[model samples]
Target chain A: MNPVVLCTVARMMAPVLLLFSLVLTVRGHDSPGGGFVGGLLATAAFTLLLVAQPEELVRRRPRVDPTRLAITGLLVALGSGLPALFLGRPFLTGLWAQVPLPGGGALKLGTPQLFDAGVYLLVLGTAMAFILGLLHGEEEEAREREG
Target chain B: MTPPLLLTLPLLVCLGSAALAHLCPRRAWPRRGVALAAMLALTAVGLLLLVEVRRQGVLAVQLGEWAAPFGITLVADLLSALLVLIAGVMGLTVVLYSAATLAPELEAGAYYALVLVLVGGVCGGFLTGDLFNLFVWFEVMLGASFVLLALEAKQEQFEATLKYMTLSLVGSAVLLTAVGMLYGVAGTLNMADLATRLPGLERPGLVSTVAVLFLVAFSLKAGAFPLFFWLPASYHTPPVAVTTLFSALLTKVGVYALVRTFTLLFTQDVGLTHTVLLVMGGLTMVTGVLGAVAQYDVRRLLSFHIISQIGYLLAGLGLLTQEALAALIAFLVHYIFAKSALFLVSGATARASGTYDLQQMGNLYRSHPLLAALFFVPALSLAGVPPFSGFFAKLALIRAALRAEHWLIAGTAAGVGLLTLFSMMKIWREAFWKGHPQDPAAKQEAPSSVNVGWGVLGPCAALALVMGVLGLGARPLLELADAAAGQLLEPTGYIQAVLRRPP
Candidate 1:
């Protein structure tokens, strides 16, 4: 079902795609990209790897269950809103801070960015769960047929 | 507590419990404990909110510290607070019931988490101040409900869920379209802002079109006529506990949205918009009762009754008088407790008789007198009999209709009450009064002798008792409903509170 060339390309591109997704997620607060898009990109990367090597990926399950990961991400997103309440602001009021970078530039950080990170994780986990669930179903059917 | 914190606490408790339950898949006690504690916390929050809203008039908070008309707002007027309180109580009771009756496999599959999410969504829907936020909450509720409907599903359940899912998605799309069009017209999504802006818009006709769209979407959700085919089809498919939760909260949320929007935002043309609701409500009643009359299955029959009762609610809304709205709120409170008790009783009845079919079942009055008593209180109440909340609820609605001089709807309301009584009597005769068809002596061992545990019967008894209390002490609740209706009729205070204007 697979071509050698396709497998090799997927293996090589997956890591690069993941790194690019992180960049997109972090830069989302100021510009066009955000958590949703970045999460989809990361899912695409994982999807490529799974499609190229379904057996290996399925056999060696990820350390964190996708469902739990998604739940954790949701908790993180909800938690991000709590800090403002502590500060006597509204539930989701964004608070910002500036960090002095080693390169002498100030890095702007905010709760919204943290929120986007949570969204990133949630979307990634949910999508992966959906894909992996389908793969497992197909695998079970195939095994049943063979047996 | 601050308004934002108070408003968001139920949602936080629910989501937090959902996560906690999801993380501990193997530990049954921890999951149950968390779910129980979370619902108790939700109930406490709901009580606090009700008291606060009663004292403070309307409580509004702008999330993200944004000014009104821009940021998402959470508002809890009396109506919202009351509905939240009902949802919290319903969640707690259903959790207790599930602990006894739910299958082990389903419980392990994160059923509690799903229920918590669904309750949270209902609370959010009740409390949200923005139109788009209402839509978001609807989606959240739908998402949880879809999984609940299909979790450990049978073939019939899968089919029913498909129908339910398709219809609900269409409703959501229609709702989103209406919201978008309204925003494009009014330049705001806040309910109060929309209320103010919609009337001032030059094109009253365009506004009415959007209003009708909102009506259709919410009508579908409320299980109103011509759009309620999904209810009886899918509702009877889920397990009893799930069915009870859905019966108690889901369509009522739809009714809440209808009352909220029509009274607040679409009053510019009550003659046009509400009249449509009036006609729809009447048809919904007749059709729903007739559907019940033809059914022999216990759950399906009760499902039809849900639609019929919804008709009374819509008719009350259609009347649009202060008295009618008050009656509607009172009716809603009565209906939730009564209907949930009925569903729980049906589950227990099925357990005792080994069948949901009335044709095969009988002698429940002889076999289980307590179950019969549990059944009678709600059944009589539902039939608008005296000494129960449903009677006062119906009486108030009929009086409101007569006062408004809506003679036709008034007649329909009375006639429907009679039909409701007929069906309740039919159930009583078939399930309890008559002897079992196959076992004339009614001594044969029934299948599935697993006793309906206290966990199952206790909530039913508690809910039935609540109906009794609400009926006997209808004075206080009537006053509360009257005040809530006053708020709905004159939304100026609501608007001022949300917009931070001096009133």
Candidate 2:
């Protein structure tokens, strides 16, 4: 099932998909694209890699365990709410700031963006965990049949 | 000290511990330690929230400082506070029980993290003031429970989980549909706003239809009659600790939503809606008790009883009186403690006898007198025996039913009580009184006796003691329930607090 052309295409597409996911996440503040969709995109990128190179992906596990990644995302999301509490506002109150670029244009940032980032990581981790778990189950079944 | 802090602290502690537990994958003790600390902190915060709510009336905060009906609001009236407190205490007990009984394979599967997440979801469900937020909490709980149920799946476990998951997803779909319908009709998803707007809505028929959808969805979740087939099928499949946690919190969450929605938002058509509830309650009780009587498996029998007791809560809600709601709240508090204790005791008994079948178990009276006594207290309480918490709970509910002149339901409640006693006695005679089926003389020598550790017994005893205390000190809880009932009946204060507008 692993054709050379398909593998080559997947290798190229994976990086592009990941980069696009980040763009979607960052632009989600006032647009249609948000963390949830962006995270799914990132998961799709990983899925492409796994399909093209299953053994390599399995042997060299991702840098972050999927379960831990989801947990970290949850902490990040919850932590985003804490800053508002410290500022004496209600929990999850958006605190915004403007950062000026070298060219004099300013970038607007807020707690909601932090929350979107958290959602992005959470969605990616959770989807990958489900995919990997199913793949691992199939592999085990195949091994059992061979034995 | 702030309202938002009180509402969110339990969730933060739970998720924080979950994250911490996941950080160390290979180690068990560190995760256990984190869970234990988190549960202790949860219980302490729950108590503080209860106290603060009592002092300040209704405590509410709109997240992000958003205006009412626009942003998410968290509110802790007496009922929410009480439920949160019970959830915290039950979480603590279940975590302790799990520490002793959970298999190494399960522990390595991130079991503690899942449990903490489930508790956090339960707390969020109790505290949220928006309908959509409540749905979100339900999903959180459902997701965690699905994983927990199938964590180290065997063939039968997977089958049970499939049944559970499918039915729960259907319930969620129905719930979301109802939420959408309500929003379409009223143009808002905030519960406080809904309460004010529902009665005045021009489309009364549409409102009733949405209410029925809500009833069906919550009834499925609460394991009420005709829709409760999934409960007994799946509840007995999980590990005992998992079963204990589910029995303690999950169904009650459904009942809580039912009570909250009916009293607050659906009061416009009590004659039609409450009557259906009354009939459903009666049937649920009858079916549940009869089912319990027919079961020989201990967990399955208790699972049926959970359904029966939920009927009592529904009946109390059907009466639609302040006294009735108060009695229902009292019953809820008693039921959670008694039911959890019973499940823990059954788990211990199963451990000692190496079987869950009542027909296969015997001679615990002589072999483990302490465990026998521990089981007796909750069993009797569950059967509504006097000087135990369940007696007072049942008595109050019956009195409320009588005063409300719900003669048939009141009679059904009493009849169901007698049947419950019979089933509890069935368990007693089979598990504790009868001699061992294999070898009566060799029962003490059974190797499984060593497996029943203090970790299980300690929580059982503590819960039994709590039942006893609640029985002896029933007045305070009754008063608290009365206040909570008042708040539910007259949700004006809740609405005013959340919306900051005159109704």
Best DockQ among the predictions, by candidate number: 1
- List iRMS for all predictions: 1.1, 1.3
Tens digit per residue, CA lDDT, model 1, A1-147 = 556788899989999999999999998888989888999999999999888875775477654667777888888888889998887677878999999999799989889888888889899999988887787878644743453
TM, chain A, every candidate: 0.87, 0.88
Off by over 4 Å in 2: A1-14, A49-62, A100-105, A133-147, B442-451, B501-503
Minimal lDDT window, size 10, model 1 chain B: B441-450
DockQ of 2: 0.64
Compose the digit string of candidate 2's lDDT tens values, residues A1-147: 556877899999999999999999999989889999999999999988888874865557645668668878878888889998876668888899999989889989889999999999889988988887787878645643453
lDDT of 1 at B6: 89
Superposed model 1: Cα runs more than 4 Å off: A99-107, A138-147, B443-450, B501-503
